[model samples]
Target: MTKVFRLKDLDCANCAAKMEHCLNKIDAINHVSVNFLTQKMVIEADENEFETVMQEVVKVCKKIEPDCKIIM
Candidate 1:
């Protein structure tokens, strides 16, 4: 399934890029995009494991930018 989430307090475009890269590397993820200009993240992942993948995505985002939040 594909999902779009709003991000809060994303620090910079570089961090957004980093998050996009990390999220795309996940096994269940089919595609990922993090847009600093819009403060949003788009993820397409295995439907059966979507929630699990999203949990990991949140962790990855936190690691990239401690203050960043993906509003579920």
Candidate 2:
């Protein structure tokens, strides 16, 4: 399953890159991209585990940028 989410207050390109790298490390996530310029995120994961994968995505993003929000 693939979903696109708007990002709020994503601080920098470096953070976006870090978020992309970390999110892609998840076993359940097939792919992920964080675009700082566009303030958007695209995630691809197993349909059955999409919700759960998003929860992890949020956590990982927060760790990198505390004020950043992934608009569901």
Q: Going through the candidates in order, what is the number of backbone clashes in each? A: 0, 0
TM-score of each: 0.95, 0.97
Rate residue 18 of model 2 by lDDT: 93
RMSD of each: 0.7, 0.5
Task: Write the residue-wise lDDT of candidate 1 on 1-72 in tens digits.
Answer: 888999999979999998899888998899999999999999998889998998899889889899998899
Best by TM-score: 2
Question: In model 2, where do residues sit more than 4 Å from their true spots?
Answer: none
lDDT of 2 by residue, 1-72 (tens): 889999999989999999999999999999998999999999999999999998999999999999999899
Give Cα-based local distance difference scores for all models.
0.91, 0.94
Q: Output the number of the lDDT-best candidate.
A: 2
TM-score of 1: 0.95
